[model samples]
Target: CAMASLWMLLVCANAAAALLVCLYLWLIAWPRWKRETRARLKVADDATVVAFFHPFCASGGGGERVLWKMVHTLAQLHREKKRSLHVVIFAQKGPKTPEQILAGAEERFGIDVSTEGGSGGGGSMKIDFVFIETELIDLLHAETWPRFTMIGQSYGSMVVAWRGFQTATPDLYFDTTGAAFTLPLGKLCGARCAAYVHYPTISTDMLAMVYSRRPSYNHDSAIASSKLASLVKCVYYFLFAGLYGVAGAFANVVFVNSSWTRDHIEALWRLSPAPTVLYPPVNVEALA
Candidate 1:
């Protein structure tokens, strides 16, 4: 009778332990993970947030121009449709404020981004800037190991994106820079992800060069000169390309800068909905 009682006690103990684990997962772990996912921004219940990942937000380059233009476009849509749309820019810490960045974009591009409720205008749409520290991203840099540079940076950007959106995730996650790693994280938070890829991380042309053992832009002096070096480099690139494709697969939609880029990305990602070609916007009047 004692042995049977002990056996029953052991069974009860196991059952209790299992129940505790389940309770922790439901009451603690899941909720904690949810809170961590939205740790960055405190979002309004009614607001439709659009988060943009642009590490070089202040840089008045082609990518920055696209970023600002997108903000302007959304602001215009918000005004026309009479909806509350908020734009959040995830960037590395810079001296400029969101207003300053918008102002700088105006000065550099000669485009009007002012909305009815914004500082520049009375537009209802607002732009918020979330700055990520370099230290967070520095851990992912592949400078020490040069061969895996693309994979390292891509993973680093993903980490940055994950943290950047943890506070207040957007309804739509748009990557102005070619960081496919951010897509999965955005999706995890129930955000639709899109990317404007300036160039494919790895192209068939690169693989072809490797396969043919031909010296191309990807093959430097050392790699091109030696057959063994070329073979090793080719294998590295092939592996990296596969990794890149997997990362890119997370994106719901992709927009390439040019037809050339579109073809390569389409071939690599093989996305069911093919990527669209969006030529970089040019200020016709400014150029004239």
Candidate 2:
């Protein structure tokens, strides 16, 4: 068992090292590509824009639906000369590609929009989606991405908040759900962050299946397997909760998707500095 533990630790350390190395190489190759791509695309370095940034915008969930709705609204707004939007999807690893998402949107909404993979697709006025996962750390380090609003749903949202906190990017972080460690990260980054949370965390819910104390529903498989490992995760969660408090305090705005989410966030961080709300959008007949 001890040898197995050592092997796991070694594997994780190696993976971290590889990621760092990849990030380094990506940054070095970015500038030349940026110059050539921009020249080809004919876009000036800076442009005014509003963006819908979704890190975890997958197929047809509430968050995905809301994001597409936002995109449609932005498209209409731009048509009427009311606004200029440059949507970006900084999706995480282990998700659909930008093209895949674009195809999905077209199929569902009958809206035809295409996104560029890199910073410059040589377009003058249009929304662009850049998929920046671990592979695009070079783009991230290049710091060429324009400032825009970032919207994340579920785990993607939490990751966006965490990345914002780590990189200090000038962005507005919006979370639709999965408000785990993100609030604290948003607060730390000092970004204009908001959460459209669906419900308060299970920690705040006495009747939650997660905290039933009955062994059956407990997700602590490590604990069920071994008392020692379970104890470690418990301690980890407790420590993790403390870190969440620190990160959440950085958010400037907190808009819960439902009353349940608001209550959960409030309960978890009773003294959080961010404002809370239930900001549901108007439901048109088309939505039905």
Candidate 3:
């Protein structure tokens, strides 16, 4: 009788906690987010707003090159069309200003990004930065189980994107970092969503490694060597692949960097709308 009473008390406590969380989100978080988003990104009637999710904006890698090139291309398009386009980059706070990032991009890729509301050569398209602290992401990595790392990162990114978009949802949500988890959130916010998938989160090759009991990237030396460990990891990959497919499905449009990537994504994701292949942006002339 006492144990039954204790179980009921625990259930009641959990239910209360769930209710409180819902109340906080509905009453406190949503309204404040709406107010802040409107205040920060005051969209002009003529402007078309596009948000790019690039958490690692300062890491001037190939992906960063793609981002800068895309922005430049869009700016040129808007110029030709005589339309105002606002590009918002959701990034982590850094030592450099948006102007410095633009300068770095120009120096590296020879692409020009014009400054807005500043003393500089007049550039038509407006650029804005929405800085987010990445402590939550770091904490997720620290706290989550190793076997579920990929899924945790995917879900964590979705939460981060949700928070970032709370103030102002963009007309288009573009994920340059291959984090397809943000697609559903973007769609929820009424934005047309797209993702440039560098690679599928989990590939058939990864599954084959587990299936054949061979050591692979997904498994460490210890796990790969042990038959028992290999079997366990095979189950993990199977479940993760299903979850990844669900996340990829949320994308309204998908762009892949290469034919190899498109093949893998298509085979794995089975997305209804076939992915478009956009060759990686490389400055061959600059290199020459």
- Write model 3 residue lDDT over 1-288, tens digit each, in one string: 999999999999999998787678656765566456545676555566789998777678999988988999888766665666778898876788888888888887788877555211224677788777767445235266465777787877887787678745687889998888788777656567889988788888888877887765556878888888878888888988887777778788889999999888888787536899999887789667
Q: Which candidate is the best by lDDT?
A: 3
TM-scores across all candidates? 0.79, 0.54, 0.81
**Model 1 stretches with alpha carbons more than 4 Å out:** 1-44, 115-122, 137-145
Between prediction 1 and prediction 2, the one with superior lDDT is 1
Tell me the spans in candidate 2 whose CA falls farther than 4 Å from its real position. Answer: 1-53, 74-84, 92-100, 109-125, 133-170, 177-190, 199-202, 206-212, 220-234, 271-288
Compared with the true structure, all predictions reach lDDT values of 0.76, 0.50, 0.77
* TM-score computed on alpha carbons, candidate 2: 0.54
Model 3 misplaced regions, further than 4 Å: 1-39, 117-123, 137-147
For candidate 1, report its TM-score: 0.79
TM-score of 3: 0.81
lDDT tens digits, residues 6-105, model 1?
A: 9999999999998797677556654565454334344444557788998787888998888888888878777776566777888878677777877888
Please give the distance, in angstroms, between residue 232's alpha carbon in candidate 1 and its true position after superposition.
Answer: 2.8
Residue pair clashes in candidate 3:
37-167
Q: Determine the C-alpha RMSD for candidate 3 after optimal superposition of all C-alphas.
A: 4.7
lDDT at 218, model 1: 57
